[model samples]
Target chain A: MKKYGSLIGQLVIGALIGFFGMLAVLDGDFRIDLSPYAYPGNLIILAAAAVLAVFSAYRYVSIRNLAKQDLSGEEEDAAEGRMYRHYADASLASTLAILFSLASMSLSLLTTQPLWLLIFGLVLIAFSFIISGILPGLMKNMYPERDLPSITDKKYAEKLLNVSDDGEKHIMLGGLYKTHITMNSLLLGAIVLLLFYSIASDSSQLFSIFIIVGILAITNTQYQFSIRNK
Target chain B: MKTRLKELRARLGINQTELAKRAKISRQTVSLIERGEFMPSLLIATKIARVFKEPVEEIFQFEEEELK
Candidate 1:
């Protein structure tokens, strides 16, 4: 799935932004001083968070609708390919949703202002609900369980069995399998590092990083599971 | 590079969907194969050949330029 390049790119960008936010918080120097009493900027940040939430909801619907179109009566292999393509697209959208939430959280960390922090926290909360709850549920519906092949359908089974094990297929499958394992391991390691850092820092701000990293871990795990199962 | 898939399927009185289902592939792939837009891998070609009880050479042929 080189088709997933864009999704991976978005994820990398989000990670970079989160990294910079961590640096800003670590510096402990407040740059761009605003009136401590000024609630106007806080209100604007909150409004922006609200707008993101609405946009996320709209985008979620749009992604689902686009995926649904892939299910039109088509050849089984092409349909399967379409299903995979949909997964990639939906995942990209989900990553964006997570990024928006993380953006809010990172903003909170940078400002260290209680109101801005709270608003960003709420943004993360809303997106967590969407990404974890709604999107997975929709995916489950899109890819329902299928019955295992029986021995009685031997002819069709025989045909289906070795159709994907040719040389090129093997190379492609091996490459994807290796990529998934490597990425999953790296993401799991990152989550562990985040956990250790949060403990060492004794800071709640780092918890946001921990949460976003945890979310990424879940996404990676789910993708690997889907690839193996499908 | 070229295939007699459409002609053969017509002779068998079958549609693209039926051929795809029997071959355990997508109709889109079958259509692409017929239109010479996509070449089937060996495994798929074998499966399709089995469906027709024919040899792969009979179903698919490479043009002179393609052989080059």
Candidate 2:
């Protein structure tokens, strides 16, 4: 019970959010309008992008320095562990920064906001792309003994997976299995909600429902095919 | 399965990262094995055993229910 306390809390919160979202979808009068708050929202998004950019840069530099250092004793081993964690953090932060910047740009274009905001978004997108490109190189630095393939390599994913040890593969298997199950369940729930919304509201969500079902079928088929021979 | 990995590493004056390197696995995997959250595969078990110069059963011990 104690072990599942947090999971139960999250499920309850998710249920509440889903209920409210369904209510809003069903209520004809409830419409979402972002026009009024477009400028303020874009500003907040820009702030977030800037913060993430700075954090990713800091992490990148820290990891680079840690990788280059030749420490002895327990510190070397500790540094190795820290370097891996910092690399993951930097990768995530840079990816989020790119996404947030892209969102800001799209919002600005749709709202016909100021040119400066769009320019900032473009600059951020370029910066994040560069950071993303350099991250795989940093991984090579950390594991100089291993012949890690470049990100641009055609078979990078296969090569990378092949390089992983059995334990790492086991962990990936567990995580991917959980993700597959969760995604299927969530997409089914989404399809049900779309069905209800289409029946109750003026807008027909038939296309969206079709797309979700297609996705579900394709993903399940892909999983089955991947494991069929294995 | 519970492992004597942490005990062996302590005796050898090595950290998780070093043990992982010696075993050709990730440090997180070593940490998980020590915490009994993850059970290593046969190959990984043999690798870890080689690193510690011990037999696989001597390092990893499982109860009857776990075996079932």
Candidate 3:
């Protein structure tokens, strides 16, 4: 969610992840048998990817607009939901990445060399995203809402809470919520896989441990900083 | 955390929606501040005080932390 990123940015991220997955194929990082891409049924996968890309773009625009607007009561709630939807859109990228990566793994499985290395690489992709996403929730507690730099702006700070003041940072909370949720979901899945891998080796446990620690810390913070706290 | 914001708004004859419009913040923010669902930032606290023509401390007292 950098200021300059848009649908194109997301696509770029997707392509890069996909490219690494392709590397997963060539290097035998993991292995799975893939249905050939030329098959008519595989066209569905391509179409799904296209749809995910479009949805991600729409959500990106909607949440970004929320961040910019200064709306009122009901409108603010609506905007929050829209921002959440935007984060939800990114899951499609994740889903596709999982599917395609698996396809590559399956293709590798057909060869003589086992693709154990690719599994490790896919695990890395999942680990990075989850940790990044969970970072905010834990950090949010450390960073209280009372001193946001935005609140210091003359336009937002000195003025009364006018509709216009809500403009720049209006729907930010919602957007943040979405970002965390999408990240958490992806991380959760990753952690589960890591759990399975744990029976074989200790390395897989590291990421899941971080995830659990992060979740507990964030939950504690959420309750501690809840608005209802006395 | 419940506030006298409603009373202040009524005294000024400003509807919540109108006050929200004037404040450049959402009505939910106003409501939340009043109900104590979310603490306002210092700037927002000041803004509320400004709307009521009062000091920020008067409008938003910190809750006394309970002794453990």
Candidate 4:
């Protein structure tokens, strides 16, 4: 059943792309007047996109299973956990879109074939991942994946931490909430920049940001947050 | 990062269950807090302080010198 389901999904994806590719060719945009493989680049990307969609979806389910099993009783709010998981999935999808776009761009530039159609197709697929996969997935999550718990009710958390006095409680709470906001806002800011770059027709800018985001994620989560908590 | 929660509880002569009931947190959370493996949130810290009849500052303190 699973096999057939995946097969059907891939077929549908291919058919849709094939139809679009044929339409583009029929409209006559081929620079070299050869449309036999005018959209081979597109076809390849569509196929790759199908595979990635299925793979990421499968991994998401697996991750969800792991989270549930590991935090069986630990999940104080199931909905909140699910929300954060969704955000993580959205972030993952955006990441995949950027990667695939880069791949198609490389193939187009490296080969003698003018893959304008392929470029068009890759852009469409990237948009699909970003809109359908990323946005929807994140809508279900309360927090983005890279952020910490953000000091839920810093006062309560402080109280738990043995912080006394009304004055200090306010500070701890403010600090925690501020940290959460800043961290999330930064990721959001980066996402906005990348989205604008992609729209302005320059996904190349996303390459550096990805690296920067990864480094920040590691440093902030592993070292800064860890040391502070310790 | 080690905490004296267990010793403190012992000094107060309260069992884990009783302490958790007072803190309104799960027994597992209490156990985790006492072990110093997982940090408590502000609310939980306040609850712990209230249980100990002390300011949260006294109940939870940094081991090293203050940041100053």
**Runs of candidate 2 exceeding 4 Å displacement:** A1-31, A181-217
| Worst ten in a row by lDDT for model 4 chain A | A139-148
Question: Per-residue lDDT for B1-68 in model 2, tens only?
Answer: 77898789989988887787787787778877887788888989999999989999999998999889
Better of 2 and 4 by lDDT: 2
Docking class of 1: incorrect
lDDT of 3 at A80: 52
**Stronger candidate by DockQ (2 vs 3):** 2
With candidate 3 superimposed using the best TM-score fit, by how many Å does residue A133's alpha carbon deviate from the native?
21
Q: Candidate 2 clashing pairs?
A: none
**Candidate 2 lDDT score relative to the true structure:** 0.87
Rate residue B66 of model 2 by lDDT: 86
Cα interface RMSD of each candidate? 6.2, 2.1, 8.1, 10.7
- If you superpose only chain B onto the true chain B, what TM-score does each candidate give? 0.92, 0.92, 0.79, 0.82
Lowest summed lDDT across 10 adjacent residues in model 1 chain A is found at A143-152
Model 1 ranges with Cα > 4 A deviation: A1-88, A112-230, B4-20, B26-38
For A1-230, candidate 4 gives per-residue lDDT tens digits of 99999999998996687567556555653333223553475457656755555555554555455444433232433433454455466456646655665666655665555666456546656664645443433322322322222343445434445523333244456767788668766875676556444434423557767876886777568756766987
Specify the poorest-scoring 10-residue window by lDDT in model 2 chain A. Answer: A25-34
Q: Which of the predicted structures, 3 or 4, would earn the higher DockQ when compared with the native?
A: 3
Question: What's the CA error at residue A192 for candidate 2, in Å?
Answer: 7.4
DockQ of 1: 0.22
TM-scores vs. true structure, each candidate: 0.42, 0.80, 0.35, 0.32
* Residue A15, candidate 2: C-alpha displacement in angstroms: 12
Is model 2 an incorrect, acceptable, medium or high docking prediction? medium
lDDT by residue for model 3 over A99-193, one digit each (tens)? 65454444445433335535643553464345334322321222222233343355653342332234224445666678767866676656655
